[model samples]
Target: MTVFLRLSAAAVTAVASCQAVGALAQEVEPSDRATTDRLEEIVVTAARRPTTFQDADVSVTVLSRIQLEQARIRDIRQLDGVVPNVQFNESGQLGSTFISIRGIESNPFIVNRAAVYIDGIPFRELSNAVLNQVESIEVLRGPQATLYGANSESGLIVINTRAPTDHAVYEGRFTTTGFQGGTSAMIDGFAAGPLSETVSGSLAFKASTSDSFLRNIQPGRPAGEIRENFLQGRLRWKPSDALTINATAYVLDTNAPGVFDQEYLPLDVDLYNRTYAETYNGGRTIGQFTYVNDAPKKTEELETVAGLSATYQLAYGTLDAAVSYRKLSTDARGLDVELTALPTSAGQDYKVKTFWNGELRFASPADRPFNYIVGVSHYRQDDRRFLATFVGPGELDDFVPAPVQLAEARDWGAFFSANWTPTALPALTISGGLRYDRAHRSADQTAGSLDLGPAGIFVYRDASLSGDFDAVLPRASALYRVSSQFSLYANAAKGYVPGGFNLTAAQADLADQVLRYDSETLWSREAGFKWRSSNGRFRLAGAAFYIRADHWQEIQVATDEEGRLISSDYIGTDASIDSKGFEIEATAEPIDRLTLTANLGYTDARYRNLQLDADTNVSGERVKLVPEYDGYLAARYQASNGLYVRAEAALTGEESLESRGEAIQPATQTIGLQLGYEGPRWSARLFVDNLTNVRRSSGLAFRNFAFGNDGNWYAPIARSRQVGFELGVRL
Candidate 1:
């Protein structure tokens, strides 16, 4: 609460200061004005319809192409500081990214709380390479289930790739980066042209390889390394002025050697040294970004996506239809549970063989007093997985692997949204939406066992589970246009995540109690204002939101009566969480040839009526992995000679790593600088990131007293300082 108040006060002061400066600028002569006088108007499709940013009632942030380039945001993980009230937890893997929005968290083992859409294809688990060649990125904060359906209890992210050009165009970019521990190079190319009188096509590709910054300190062990390749093609056909069709296909492949996605460390350095340093690490202290593991490490992944869409102009409205298919396969090994050279490891193989979705929608003309949109969507997926755990010796070859797990899921939804303006109140607009969604899930697990020479034989039981879940989501909002330069809005919405069965449970008796978990629901209320100067030199937007969630789902590591580890699965608890936050964003051209931008966010999220287990009650505890406050500031200057310089800083507040607040990550601040020159057909840039060499962990996992360790805390540390040069050419 204190943080929120402080942020609110600061935002108000900043807005007032900017307004005063704008007024003063008007007193100057016309010739002394900035080169770019007015801010560009941005249109977004977050509500399933095109609407101006100032007119839309939702709280959204849009990153334009220029902004993306200035911020050097090439991957999703790089957006952590630039986007307000959002964080990307990097697990140091190719496709394992966890996102947190407004204090709602997602992990690798569970479905995402927020949903992401890339070129009309839904992604529950996002990949870093998907951000390449994007036209714009839109982030909508709050419950978006009314239009996006399930798994959007937190928010939504929409990414639109650049479309095919009507005229021939070619572009290429090359970059080389040098960091503390390694060097890497990447090349990106794009080509587009007209395929025929009514058709155009575009293709883009990216290839990169690098040595991991995290080193392996053990003897004769190889250091981590990564190689990635991506390719995408897009086709657009305009049969007539009233009809259009589009198709897209993409593939991504990655290979990582000697890299364990997640690495465990000791909470107490002294205890760790006394326990295993002499025997495992040659009597050396375990430090950050260094580990000792003798197991063979490798991870391979392949992903493919294809999508098609069509739009037709109707007499009174427009109709749109889209279908998409996606598949992902992963094979991984070399996960050392003990963080030692003791030969205890794990491996997994999983394939999402069939995943597809389709949607149809109609939108009425937006130039009328009353407009509406109606849509229906269907989604389905099937997957198979195999897991192995090796305890004492030789890896997968000598161990008995776990059973093959098969799962299937299906979902369907229908939604309607409308906006109305009363004749008596022309300045006030009211909007409302409703959606009905249903989901079905089924899973089957085959029995298996593990044999430990002197220990014992562990046996697994076969199980089959099926279930159905449903929800009715609704939203309402009102916007009042005070004038052409200012507006105020308020909205409320509901969001939910469907229930699912836990097939990992081993014991039949435990299955009855932990076989299924209930759905989680959230209600959010938000109010905000947007303002722009009459001269259009400054813009500011601020919002305050409150959210309440019920039936929080958490992963529980089950243990036997004697404190022996049994299994882990998702479980619903009699707990809830309340989050309150505020965000402020502003942009201004205070003087000629210069631009300034700043944003700040604060979230006060805490648990209520919470119980982790029979013996632990964590009421009033702050949510894990949620920062209390985050902020960004940047300034850029452009000279008449086409040379530009930009400086930026990002700040992140302290956060707890676990629900019990046993481990806390301190606050961190980083600085970045860029100098570039742009010409008619060429560009070059020199950039430096993390100028102060700040070292911290991007994410943390708490695992205590497991795998015969006193305290095991796993983390993925942030990269050190980096210097890079980039060159680009267009023809």
Candidate 2:
């Protein structure tokens, strides 16, 4: 309740401020109006078709190239506050990134509830959604199953990279950043030009190196350090006026050394202070960015993606076809169960060797009174993983390997959607879509054993499992044009995630119960309005939504009948959730060359029917990782002499870190400032992030009591204050 009140007050204050600015602008001379600029019209392709922002009957947020540059948003985590009701949980690892949208949460063990698309390739894993040389980003909220199929229950994010240009262009940038404990440097370059009369090509690359902000307190131990490189290339061919083809490829490599991505700390503040003072920091309590570990740690990852797409103009409609391939491999070694300087370590090696997908679609002319689209898609993936644990002085060199797990999946879907604008009711438009999806998954495990001194030997059971799941999703929407500058829309949709087998469950007797989990489904309903002034100097959009989820999948501990710990974890489907939320976004140009933007979101999400175990029933507890409220407010002023200043604030409400609400994260507010100069041939900027030096955990996990819990929790601390300068040149 308090969070909601604070959000309401902030909203009111922002509105009043904007109104005062508008009133002040009204007193300007009539001749000064010529200097004012109208808001630019934005066109989006989130619905598998092109539509203006006001004409689309869905809740969405669009960021253009200029906005991305001004905000200095280079990655996905930076979008948390800019987009309403969205949060990114960073674990410090390159491959693990969990996302929460509108109270629907995703973790490292399960598939993402929200889907992400870069270029024409899809990503369903919990991986970093990096942005590079991107032209625009579109965030569409609600269930998008009718068009995107499964794994889009919460929402969808679409990223379109800058395409090859017909004329020659070149750009380069260099950056240096200083933080609490270290400094980093980065370089980026892009080049594009015409190769021939019918072909054009482009290349973009970035490289960076940074020292870890977190210091190691242990003697002779080093802090975590990182090095990264990225490259992308594109080719476009226009053989004829009616046909076009595009091919793109990208690669990312990351390496980290010294410390693991996470650390353990006592949950109680007093205990934390005492423990750090006595054990790690030599009687000092200032150890939030310091840790002690004896075992060697390192992580290496490589990912590659390639795609091809073609479009042809036809007599009946436009035809489009696309295909993509992706591969990700990683090897990491770090501490196992103990957070202190104990001789315990763990290792993980995984490879996604084969991931391929393809799609074909056709759409009718948009000018027609009645238009439609039809499409079909297929996806396949094969993965293999290996894990090991080590104890004693040997650490990671001498270890016990777990079962070798191999998994494969295949999916197929067909969908259709249409819009109707009857002549009798020209002011209203109705649209509907439906899709049928089928998925098959299988897994295999090789037997293995682990030997722990004095604790007895543990055996992993050999298993083979398979499952088939199917779903029919549907969606509908209606939009009413109240006036040329105002509209109202309502939408209802169903989304789902396909079922799969759990290859890691090791208990023989509980195989049937733990080996397979059912698919998860959600139904969402939303209503929203969009409005703009006559001169387009002001724009406002708002939406209210409700969602119900069934068969929600979760990663749970595997235990025997007597409640004894088992060898592995399993996926379970024994919970449901109810979520309701509302979001508001406004953009105003109160005066010439000055822009103001504000967005606020509130969500009330709770478990409906959930059983963590035989002894616990959490029916009304708040959902984990979902904040009660979040918002962003920013102001930017650009002078005619090429100088600009921007100031922004981000607000996040409290959140529960555990299912039973044992761990809570308090609300926080952060501020940022930027000063820059833009010229025809050169640009420069100086910026400060997290100006208040706020220290907090971005994510948290509980340790099992049997595996050295020590009444503490594990988490990754958020970044500290950072100041940076960037210089760029265009040729």
Quantify all predictions' global Cα lDDT against the true fold: 0.77, 0.77
What is the lDDT, from 0 to 100, of the residue 58 in candidate 2? Answer: 89
Error of model 2, residue 594, in angstroms = 1.1
For model 1, what is the C-alpha lDDT against the true structure?
Answer: 0.77
Q: lDDT by residue for model 2 over 1-731, one digit each (tens)?
A: 23433443443344334432222211222123225445668788988888988888988999987788888998878888699999887665454777788999886667789988889788887455357788899999998887887878899989888889877666667777888877777767667878999999999887777777765555556677777789999999999989999999999888877756444444454565565456644564536566666556777788899999999999878999999999988766664344555444444444545689999999998888899999999999999887666656554456556777899999999999999999899889999999999999999987786543222244666878888999999999999999989999999999998989886533344646677899999999999999989888999999999999999887677544433445455778888999999999999888888889899999999999888877888899988888999999999888777788999999999988767777787899999999998765557899999999876667645543234334555566677888999877565
* Candidate 1 residue lDDT tens string, 304-381: 999999999999999999999999887776666556766654444344456899999999998888999999999998
Give the TM-scores of the predictions, in the order they appear.
0.91, 0.91
User: Predicted candidate 2: what Cα RMSD to the true structure?
Assistant: 8.8
Our tally of clashes for model 1 stands at: 0
